[model samples]
Each structure stands twice: as structure tokens, then as C-alpha cells.
Target: MTGLVEYAERHPWLTDAIVVAALLGSGVLGVHLVGPGDSRPEDVWVADAVTVVACLAVFGARTHPRATVVVTTVCAVVGGGLGFLLTPLLLAPVMVALYWLAVTTTSRTAWTYGAVTIVLVVGTAVGADIDETVALRSVGPALWLVLPLVMGSRSRLRDALLDAVRARAEHAERTRDDEARLRVTEERMRIARDLHDVVAHHLAVANAQAGTAAHLLRRSPELTQKVLADLQTTTSAVMLELRDTVGVLRNGGADEDGLEPAPGLARLPELIEACASAGLTVDVEVDGEPRELPAGIDLTAYRIVQEALTNATKYSASGSASLRLGYGARLIIAVANETRPGDPGAGRPGYGIVGMRERAHAVGGDLRVSDAGGRFEVVSSLPLHTPAATP
Candidate 1:
């Protein structure tokens, strides 16, 4: 039985083979017992032959269960004229075929088979010349046939429902996995850009400063010390920020110790000071009450200002930018700059702009970047609390 199940699992054809074999074997057995002292040999033989053909149809039961039931039922009805002896026990194969069909097909089909089974069994019992006791007892067996049919149909339905649920669960899991992979890929790309902007740029500046210090070390020790001190400050800041960012990733974001809080409107003064050191003058302004905002909004506000200032420094010859922050129900941030004439980078936006837009949108906000009358502006506004945070 285990071998048969294994074979059926591996090869669907085996299921059909088993059905055919069962029907044919049952037919032969029924045919052998159809003869008795109560029935004529010719009549018994004819009935047995018809039953054998009908039962043999069980071979294609799964493929054509309705047809098999129809054929077997008709044969069973006609064979009644030959008495119980001629009929043999060929009804067993018919019962098995009908029950299997009910189990595999829809409920409507099962109902139809059940109605037919009831009619045929009752008609066969009543039409035959069997004793009253035997005829009465036959009803029990006829009713028993319905148990397998109903139970089998129910079992198959349950299995199909379970399979559907499992399929949906697997599909959901696959979708989640795909989204996670995409997010990771984007994060890696962002990290690469940050490394280029922060680490590479600072390292280049530090190297230049160190070279200057070396060149003046003997002749102007005071100048050398100043240059070296600036280099040390720049290098140290880079190392600290790098350690924080990389450490966050390496530790799965659990390490907050050396990590600086994300820059926000609160850090605008420091940002202005930093711009001064870089020879860029920034005018910072704040309007409206500075209420505490959601973390996402705060982070987005900071990034918008940072990206705008960075672009201004890289592309504007005027070395002057304006940073504005306003808080109402929403936080608004805007950075505008006077673009440098003949600066190729002034007109084109890069991933920094894209990152700013993405950050704004991530917090259910909007970002707008445009050039107006030779001035470039990046504006972003984010709601303090989104629908998801309303609880």
C-alpha cells in the first residue's frame, strides 16, 4: 500500500492503473459467483458479462466518474431481471467508483451521484425476487455506500482548502522576501554614495592639508601647526562619523553609543558654522513655533537642508545659500541658492536630490526642486504625524 501511494505520488498514471485493475478484478470475481442453484446458467452468464463490462469501466473512474456511474447504474438496473444470483456482488466496484467520484468532484456532482445511487439501489432491491428479510437488509448496505461518498468528498474539500491557504501564505512570504531584498540593495547603494561624499571628500581635504603642513614645517612652524591641527580635526570628525554609520550597519542598528543623532532643524547653527569653515556663507532663518516633530519628519528636514547646502557648495560660485525652517502642523524646510554662471553642475541634479525626495516621501511628505531666474531651490514639507502614527 505504501509502495502504491509512492508510485501514485511520483506518477499520476499509476492512479488510473489502480482504478482499472480494481474494476477488472472485481468484475472477474463477480462473474465467477454469479452462477447458483437458483438461476439458469445462460441468464447468470449474460448478467455476469454485462456486470463485468460495467465494472471494468471503473478503470476510467477518476477521469470519467459520471460516465462510469451512469453506465454501471444502467447495467445494474437491466441485470435485475436475472435475479440476485446473476447480479453477484459486482455492486462493490460500482460503489467504490461512485464514492471516489463524489470525493473528487464538486458538491453538485456528488449530490447527483447520491440521488442516482439511492434510486438505483431501492429499485434494484424492490424489483428483484429476493426474500422479504434479505430485501429489507439490502437497504442497510445501500445506505452504507453513502458514508464513503460523503466522507470522501468532505475530506477532499478540506485538503483543497488547506492547499489554497498554504499557497497564499507562501506567496505572501515570497513577496515580503522580495521587498526586503530590494530595500537592502537600495541601502547598500546609499552607503556607497555617503562614503563618496563624506569619507572621500574629507580624506582628500586632509591629505592636502597634511601636504601643506609638511611643506612649511621647518620654515613656518606656526603655519604648519595650524594646518596639521585642521587636518587632525577633519580626519577625526570623518573617523567618528564613519565609525557610527558603519557600526550601525554591522551591528544591525543596535549600537547607538558612538552614533550621533540624526541632524535636524536643531542642528542648523552648527551647520552654519561648518559652512563658514568651508568658505560658504549660509543665512539661516526660522519661522513658526519649533514644536517637537516625529522622528521621520525631523530626519527628512535635516537631510533636505544638508543636501541643499551640499549642492550649493558644489555648484554655486557665490558661496552664499539660504536655509529656512518653519513648523506648524507640518515642518517645512527650504534651501535656495544663487547658481554660478557657467557652472555645469548647477543645472543638473544628482542622487542627492533623489535621496532627498525619497526621504521626504518616506515620511508622507513632498519635495520640490526647481530653478527660477538663475536661483536653485529645494523645498520639502513633512507632516508631524501621519495616519499610521495616529493609533
Candidate 2:
């Protein structure tokens, strides 16, 4: 069935040929039925010739709609003017032409041509003084002509509606693809931030512990051993975390037993111990009632503090910093450290501060960094309840 329809669509002229054959048969019948076969031979020949020309004109209606409608209407009126019966069969070609005109041309053009056709065809029939009733002379031709125009207009509207639906579906599919790409990009950036914070903070502490061990080697052998032990602990913990992170990437996910819990404020004591061994003393002060936080806010807070202390370890001349946390509608974190004019690591290029800010903002929070009054300070304000999707 589908193949047949496809074949018909491929040969469009076949449709015009079928319609023309039907019109010729009906025209012949209409002429013979005129007054008990009393139509003269000359009149019959002329009517048949005019009807054939009008039916042929139907073939061009799709290409030259207005011209085709005009030609068919003229032929139909000419046949009626020669004192022949004006029946619907005799006007079949004009009806077919009007239909194609409606389908191919604009509604305004089809209707304008239809009104002109009605005026010409009906006026010729009525003014010819035929024995046919008034209804046949005027209403019959108008009804026949109007049907094709109406059907053609409806076909055009349906086709336009289908095109609009197809276009909207395509646009939605493209939007879906764009949204998928955007999500992938955001995930990559989140992973980069997490890796930077985890690796940079741990490595800096390890480096500081190593330097301390070497500086104390000759003067304090026992303390050097303790620093070396702390160094070992730091490297071991970071390796386990690195493995955990990398294993997730390699295996698509971690097994339940293999997955390590992400770090949060509960792990701040461990961070304090590591920083103390690195010769950066962190004095932590809590201003409000401490409560457990949502995972996103907890992880973001931990990373911001870790990154800020790492910067202080690298850049501060004084080996002391203050860490403060306040809990209320929002969790407030502030880290301040003394800075001197000739701090050894003052002029280094790093993304630590930027990563910290990004982590804060990811949880619907904000971070501010300022170097004022001989001190460097990082203040972050985070909501206690963060969005579920934040990394």
C-alpha cells in the first residue's frame, strides 16, 4: 500500500490524467442528456471541444493556478453561451481547476479567481435564455466550484500544520543535545576543582613537613624522626585518597568497601594535626552551636578551609593562622594569617584562591579574599542547606 502511494506521488501527471478522463466521460454524458439527444452535431462537437480544452487546462492548475482557472472558466462560459445546457458535468473541468488553484495558491488568490469564475459561468448560463431552472443556471455551478476551492484550502492548511509540528520537534531535539553537552562540561570542571583542592593541599603539607625534617636533622634528631613519621602519615593518607579517586575513574565506580567517605568539617582535626607538623599552627575558634551540615555544604567548607591554610603555609612569614567557624542560618568560615613585606612565597602564580571560590559558589555560597592591615584573610559564607547536585 505504501509503495503504491509512493509510486503515485512520483508520477504526478497520472493524477491529472485520471481526472481528465473522468471529466471527458461526464461531459459526453451531460451533452447527450441535453433535451432527449436533440443537440445538433455542430453544437455537440463545439461543446466537446471546449470541454476537452478545459479538462486539459486542469493539468496546469498546480503550476499556473490563476491562468489555469481563467482558461477553464472561459471555456466553460463559452460552451454555455452557445445555447447548450449548463450542467455540473459540463463544468467538471472548471471545478477541478479551482481545487488545484486553492491547494497551490494563497486563499485570497483562489477565492478571487473562484468569485470571478462564478460570475462568468453562471452569468453566461442565465443570460443565454436556456430552458433550465434558475437553480441550475446559478446555484449548481457555484456549489460545484466552491467545493474544490474549500477542499484545496483545507489541504494547504493541514500541510502547513504538519510542517510546523516537524520543525518544533527538530528544535527540541537540538536543545536536548545542547543541554547534554553543557552538563558534561560542568561535570568536568567540578572534577578538576576537586582534584586540585585534594592534591594541592596534601602535597603542600607534605613538602612543608619534609623541609622541617631536613632543617631539624642536625639540631634535633628525635624531633626530625617525629616530623619524618608525620610526613609518612601525610603521604599515606593522600595516596589512599588518590587511589580512591582514580579507581572510581578506572572502574566506572568504587565498590562499597573500597569507597572512602569524602572529607568534611569532622576531619578538620586531622588537617590541624598535619598543618601543625608543617610548622603552621591553626587556632580554631567556634562562635555558634556546631551542627552537622548537608554533604555539599560540608565538603565545600572543608575544601575552602584546606585551600586557604595551604596558601598561608606557602606565603605567610609568620607560622600562625586563625580559623573561625560560626553556625546560624548560614555557616560562616574565616581564615586569617599575618603577612610580612618579604614573605618568601608572596609572588607565586596559583589557582588555589580561584578554586576555593568556585567550590564555595558551587554550593550557593560565596568567598572573599582580602589582603589588608598586614594580614591575609579568606571569608566564606555558605548556606546550611545546599542544592543536592552540587559537587
C-alpha local distance difference test of each model: 0.71, 0.85
lDDT of 1 by residue, 1-391 (tens): 9997778868866676666677667665655563434443456677767877776777767788888778877776666545543232667666766777876798888778878776776677566446756756466646666766777688788889999999999999999999999999988876765665566445645665676678888999997887777778878888987887777778877555655676666776765655554546888788997887766677667667766777776665677888888877777888888987667778586777877777778778999999868899988888888548545
RMSD of 2: 3.5
The C-alpha stretches of model 1 lying farther than 4 A from their native spots are 1-4, 8-42, 85-88, 128-138, 189-232, 250-254, 386-391
TM-score of each: 0.80, 0.85
Query: What's every prediction's RMSD, in angstroms?
Result: 4.6, 3.5
lDDT of 1 at 184: 95
Residue clash pairs of candidate 1: none
User: Tens digits of per-residue lDDT for model 2 on 173-251?
Assistant: 9999999999999988887887888788889999999999999999999999999999999889888888887887789
- State how far residue 267 of model 1 sits from its true place (Å): 2.5
TM-score, candidate number 1:
0.80
